[model samples]
Target chain A: MIQDMKPEDIIGDYKETLLDLYGSICRVVLYTDIETPYPDGKLIVSTTDKNGIITHVNKSFVEMSGYTEAELINAPHSILRHPDMPPAAFKDLWDTVNRGEKWQGFVKNLRKDGGYYWVKATVIPNIRHGEVVSYTSVRRKPSRTKVDECIKLYPTLF
Target chain B: MSYLFTVSPDFTPVHLSGWYIFNTWLQRQSGSPIHLEMYNDFPTQRLAIHNDQVDLIFANPFDAAMLVREKGFLPLVKAAGVSDEAIIAVRADSAVEDVAHLSPGITVAVTEDPDVTMMGMIMLEAGDLNAGNVETTIFDTYVLVAKNLLNDSADVGIFLAEAYDDLSSIVKKQLKILVRSQISVIHHSLMVGPKLADRRDEIQALLLSMAEDDKGKDILKSLGFDNWVKVDDEDMEFMIDLMEALAT
Candidate 1:
């Protein structure tokens, strides 16, 4: 009897199912945070097109980078790139992301005041029909040992 | 009497001969024929234990550690001798002369299994090498990693002790050992399920007493055994420390 529903009704039921799935995923996200005390410290989530123009920045990113959403949304992600970072690092990162493999690394980005901070970042390429639609990144504070090691090496790589 | 064993493609003929000797020894000691069933992999052996098909097993140290921690099994004796020598090999022509010289952009090839790869990571941690900077590529086999290094497909390769004998010649001629770790002993152990805890003393006595027999001596010699020693809780503590350290 449920299968005999009208198309509109079926679509509405499908929407509800999707909303339930999304809600379940959100619950999982909340559970993970509760389980670990070392919550992901901060995140700078941004979407970029093929040409690397920034399409979005979450509020956390705006606050962390010391930029408003308006100043960042249309800007290139390189606006925050640290001068001490070697071009080869970004080149390799882009190459990995473009190939649709997730790239993970400790990156140093310059804040608006020219001071720098490090993040352990994972970049995932979003694709549709073999074409990359955008890139998304999740970042968090790395261990102090990790940050210290990268800080000592980053200047030499330039 | 029922016994369990694991068989792998990598098992040498001598390993098979050891099993025969074990079976003969068990029969002589118990005054009855023991039925032996071999599992081809650790997963199957684990399942057999879960299903109550096997009472005892020879498991890899890592697997045995998991079984002990997760299933509360008691380890009886260590079978395979332990060694802590992992090699980080770089091509003869490469610029990396030491672990400190290993640059960020250079690719380091490692074996795919985390059990094997963790040895390299441990060495890296000890050497204060930052893994975040190095490009790490994982191969299914250490030999394949060596081949990749020889072929210039990767800049560095890490090989465990088992792979050393096969890779040494190539390494000496075409590659250099940038780092050699201190020998850390990691033994493969014979384990018994929780059901056999009551019989622990008898089982330990049986294993320790085997060395007194001529047949046991022959089996031990053939299997490269020195002698079976009593295992204590202290012996297992290292494994616990290693597992905890690696988990982080």
Candidate 2:
């Protein structure tokens, strides 16, 4: 009989194996039917081309934003942009991502309901053949402390 | 010249010696010229490694894990045995006395690097402290956080213990340690990309042999190290536990 491993043990081994492989990669999955144990957070998965145009946003993105996938598709990923965000931030983000470098920052995004949410986002370039391809992003609700920091900095940047 | 990239917690002249020593050792062993660059922050260093900007870096444990998981970088050696301790600090006269007293309305300053700040947050979350009432400020470095606290801009500050050693006596005197976290597993690890992984045996051999040379000892002393050790997964499991707990 194959013995079942505890979730903690599996997570431990998986993290170490990944560390041994990639130095700074954070694996974040966006879609799921089961509820996540972490409270007050949602995962957003978005794919964009080399120029940062939106190509796909999963069901979770549509559900969380209250926007249809049809509306989101082909739109710039920043369509749901919150007014509080500074353009300089996105400029830095694009500069980094286009270079095929992953950038992590706290972002405030607006939902269709006009309410806003904060995410700790990791944006990475999906590379193929040493050429920049799509950009994949995984975002989760950041700690409230981190969120507050972003809120405080947003007004100054704008 | 072959490029050598390294990420350190900071760019102080004291911390550059390790990379210089390692680079010299690599040059002597492989007969290749090396040019080295070092970054102070974890995120920037990680980005450099991913983009192939740096060939190797001294990474924080979590950053090392992320690189191995996401970018295919190999953890080659545990550079410098120094383990950093994180501490929660407040003004000596502040009303907040314990972990429970940290609420949302209170302002806390943290360094911009997630590795250090997140570890402190994980400990607070595990203790069930009220997070909603806290206002957090993220500065570029602990020195900045210290400046903010001294200027009365923040109610609390989280900093590494070693940072205190670098501060002026007057500034250190104004601060009081509210709590020091349980010993966290953090190390400055040397990591190499896949291109250099094939040289693992040679790399390891050079690192092991460096301590015997007079020039190598100078480099080691400058980096704040007496020796290096071969650390395995078991050595880093505590950090993994902290990351999983924080992720939840």
Candidate 3:
């Protein structure tokens, strides 16, 4: 449905308000136990504006998310955010990136088909002239041991 | 959250420490954590602005257009009685005495200060010259542009008028100005982004009264300003519109 909508229809002037509305507008959760293994030796890369609006995503990212470019551009990065993720992990990620630092974690991401995949995500602030501009995120296949640790650790924190 | 503040990179070296002092004063005055970040060039600074890293800025007329129109930044104040103008110069011994005498294919050296470059190009129109006709080389700073002229690497140089005035007497002596822009309406302005919009009135009032005190006067002198004055919204809009026209 979002793909049928014009880009301008979803990209509004107020970024904060739109980010707040993304959950309700874009949520189509039909979760299954199907787990898609991360592609080998490939990176899923994406960049987002300071307000978390998706500016660019690589081919690997498009293939992994199973979404077309039209559905991703101007969409909030949170569209791929999994409901199973703990709030504390994201809070920590935001804190680190906001301080102009890099944050790395094993993340569970939701695919278009409501399947899930795990990634070793490293997010870095793209700075120019000593100012943090946008953010770049590089995701790779995560270690199964680390994913197993997170699967147990995330539940206690929540 | 600590807000980032920056000035246009065209400032002369003498005022570097003055900006630090001003930052200190502003933090104390506003009771907010403000950090000053200076870029060495326009492209890098513009990249930062494009990413929305800048919360407060003292920006040139050309950049002010993008900031106000596209980025939702509000003009807070401007240097009283000061305007941004461009100057076209050559080495004193050079045969070129007037802009009309300038020939095509002359190597023109310039910094990436957009407003000054725009004005310089407009002045070159008198010689029936345009960007296509002239060979232009971009330097990182006005000093480098001057160096290019003095070393015979460039036939002409473009400079910000204020920066030209701040040049040492020795450097000024070797340079001959063909023309200077007298458009007094365009100016650099301090603007606040949406993150700091709530404190806009408070910050504006603080800067307006700064010259009334001895401490603020000293700081203003170090920064080569007499005082900060309120910029009329209509005046700023007019300037931005003018810049948009020139850019197109």
Candidate 4:
């Protein structure tokens, strides 16, 4: 089992490499079903390119997403975007991280085979040399109450 | 997508507009867009820094000194050439010709600007006059100081050496410097947050090369600066010392 730790809990840099065009998100699927609950004390770490392409994922993340390393290595981060997840939530995420600030929110991500999991994720600017080269995200099991609150508020962002 | 570019609120909005060209150029060079921000008060800007709401700032000496000492901000670059100083100017026709000839109780106009205030204080001290010795009127900017001085509201104007340069020609002919500040006037610092430290070399290179580009020359001219050079830590230290003295 991958060590039950946070990304900050992991020592040293988490490496990933995915370079997609800045924007190429066309798939929009919203499933009505709210699926499995992410367990306590588990963190899913992922890194994205400047364009939000999935470049790297930790073992815990891979197991949770049910995608092999090859399936996610160059996919858009939106591949994990869940339908019930509010667009406003992601908008807030972009707004915060775009300003080079860290943003934390409840995210509901989809799996490769149509399963889903909810997490409270923190996105930090991976700034190198006064510029944001990419973003590093660490997601942990979120409380049911907080996820419920976000679920109620997410759709209003659109 | 864009970084907040804050300037001291001590400057009026009209004055703040002067950085548009430079800010745009920086956005292009750094690959980060910029949101222009200015404050009417220093404390508000200080709060933004504490909150990490600012990525870069064009700060006056006093505030810059405080931020550098307190925050982990990196002083990236400064204007390339020309000396920045403060001066005590009198109406050309005034009988008071120099610092030594002035007597106590004469009114002097100065801004609350840290740079102007510090320089004025230093020059006043040199003339054996402190705030107690003179009737001082503090405005928000040196431009206001010059206005009050010309209107006969004050006997002397204490302002930036460059403000005198920007004056209307007729206004220019009406004032003469009675005392120039020898105290090292702190240069403007283009500072970056700690998060940007890794990109220091890239930012510095872009700034240093700004004047070399054809379009950059125009931008620099409009901003009243010639070029940008890597920051000098000695000057940074002096500014810190100045602020420290003020605190004590």
Candidate 5:
């Protein structure tokens, strides 16, 4: 359900919580022009339950997200899901993964510092005993060209 | 009317035929026309459950929460004296003798079993590994997870203890178990949705008494169980709460 709502509508309460957690200096709920550079030769990885709650995060993921291990654990993955991303794109992603397929795309992720980072993400369903219990998402640095194409394409989708 | 029955997808590949055999026996015992449909993945099976297509299911501990709480599935039976656990293993020759010796940027292979993965990841903390420092690859089967380790595709592997035990001796020889979880309360259970609520007691009785007969004993062996036992609602609830706690 949170997937369909706009960021402004969803982050209002969340923003207040962040403000309380880190005081006014914490601007995680706000969008900014800053871009967190994806480290070269490193992959950011995380796993989530079927509902998209973060179950595990690699160090690269922690560094890129700007959130401590405690804050990110059990948090909805949508915390990093950027508003600039068209809802349709996410809808497509959900549909594909739910169908037990891998989904590949460039994502604009919101960091805890309010900056954003682009990633070439591959989400694969981990199926055991013929059932998908969770998802493992492996993300790497997206090429500048692909990021640019998504920046143009996502707007049209909106 | 006829009803639908299914099992969790994570059953050992060797037991593929056992489910069919049991389904046939169930039809005879219940005196009803029940169709068995085995879903290959959780999403499709969950969709089936969501659409009310499944009347009976033998579900894992994680999926049991949804069945009992969301879908009104009642606990019928669970395997006797069995609990699900996770084991962390590495290639026997790998230099990382202890989990603490492992470092960042290591690739960890795993499957979709949530309870196992949750336990596996928790165990990795000894080595200071988390999602951000280690790369994770999700394989479709435990055999693939073993293959990934054998071929040196992954530095470490998280396996369901049962699956790890089922691996060929040659594969097990090349690998060394780093750790195994001993949480003994959690396990899979056979449950019946609201549609089959009326037959709940009868089915439970049938399952619990299966060991009394030779044929039933054979079926039990095929499914990798000694016998079926009644599940205490409170114990199931506790496991569900534990799963929720671990997942977060």
Candidate 6:
């Protein structure tokens, strides 16, 4: 039902505010200190409505998030936000795709069981008639060099 | 053995790679070999700078100044004819007319460098707007800042003034500069380490001559500069100011 809205309807100010509130309140389930990086050549894909509520997800995204398809659809994409990811980085991501450009960066995602995974992700605006109505994100296993760089840099950004 | 060459990813790889032609010229000039590296993340770069692995580096003015002051490095040359100014951009149709005109809830886009982004914030504060004058968003590169304004993700964007010529015509047509600043900024610089002290004058002379000839001009233009100029003490004063502000 949410995905069926017109572009203006989709940008409802209340939904943007609600997601921000929801992101602050949500908690992740705790697990051991396991860090599994998705193997090279595998992609985790997901699409969210203009408000960032998940509308479609691929098998890889489901596996990495550790949430079933049923559990993920209609959920806020923030479910995968890792504690280590800086708010500024997300600000950059939103600032990029919202401008109708593709944003590529290193991301650390929180799994359903509270484990963490890192990937190099690119998010692009899905535009129709010059209006962005949704966003599509594809994440892939990050190279060791990028991961090494992120580990040293992310601490300060947070 | 190859000489070590390093450059900061101040500009994006997609827009232009800092090391591309300069590395080739440096290698061809010296002729043993050269290993060039680009470091964008600041922390890792800090470690590398302190490790003494870098023989020569191209970096933003403030960082080059810091390295010269604290790390026993020597300032060599910079791209001539650029003020290295950063500008604040807004949608052509946006109601915001100036810094003071910015209302609450407006978003300001910027590049990720703390020093550069803070410079924009400082100027905004000087315009009588408080810290929360607008939402600031950090992009990985300066070129993308203008894209934020064109797309309506931001009402204002602060980006390198030198890069304005590189924006697509469509995006360029839709934006206007609401503010411009030559203060709190430095152009790019090439600096040499202490190990290369004996060869500094020779290297600087060669690099300067490269920007004067036709073929070398082509290389320089491709690297996003018109010519190379020797760095003088006066050229570093702004960087000193920037360092002081960053320290606080």
Model 5 chain B: ten consecutive residues of lowest lDDT: B239-248
Tens-digit lDDT track for model 3 on B126-241? Answer: 56567999999999888889989999999999899988887889999999998876656668899999899888999999999999999999999998889998985655765664
Write down the DockQ of candidate 3. Answer: 0.01
The B-chain TM-score of model 5 reads 0.96
> For each of the candidates, what fraction of the native contacts does it recover?
0.00, 0.00, 0.00, 0.00, 0.00, 0.00
Docking class of 5: incorrect
Using lDDT as the measure, the top candidate is 3
**Top TM-score prediction, candidate number:** 5
The residue-by-residue lDDT of candidate 6 on B1-248, one tens digit each, is 66677876565465345457768878888664767877767666777888878888877665765687678787788877754565667888888776656666777888766555654554454344435556778887656788777777877787766666568788878888766654423466788888887788988888889966787888887776788889855345434433442332
lDDT of 3 by residue, A1-158 (tens): 23222233222221111212243454434444568887543457777889888988878888888778888988888777776787678788889999987788889996666667998787877665477878777675565667888899988887
Cα RMSD, each candidate = 19.0, 15.1, 19.5, 23.1, 13.3, 21.7
Clash pairs detected, candidate 4: A98-B1, A129-B198, A129-B199, A130-B199, B9-B39
lDDT values for all models: 0.59, 0.62, 0.80, 0.69, 0.79, 0.67
For TM-score, candidate 1 versus 6, the one ahead is 6
> Per-residue CA lDDT of candidate 6, range A28-50, in tens?
22333558766433447677888
Model 1: lDDT of residue B220: 72
Query: Could you tell me the fnat of model 4?
Result: 0.00
For residue B59, give model 6's deviation from the true position in Å.
1.3
User: Which is the better candidate, 1 or 3, if ranked by DockQ?
Assistant: 1
Per-prediction TM-score to the true structure, in the order listed:
0.52, 0.56, 0.60, 0.55, 0.61, 0.54
Model 5, B114-156: lDDT tens digits are 6678778866754557788999999999999999999999999
Candidate 4 lDDT tens digits, A64-150: 886688877887777777656656677788889899887877788866545578876778776554788777776655555566777
Better of 5 and 6 by DockQ: 5
Q: Model 1 segments beyond 4 Å from truth?
A: A1-158, B7-16, B30-54, B79-81, B104-114, B126-141, B166-172, B183-185
lDDT by residue for model 2 over A83-128, one digit each (tens)? 5678778888888977767777878765544445666677877655
Over B69-147, each residue of candidate 1 has an lDDT whose tens digit, in order, gives 6677776776535443467778888886756555556777986444455556545543344577667897766778888
Candidate 4 CA-lDDT value: 0.69
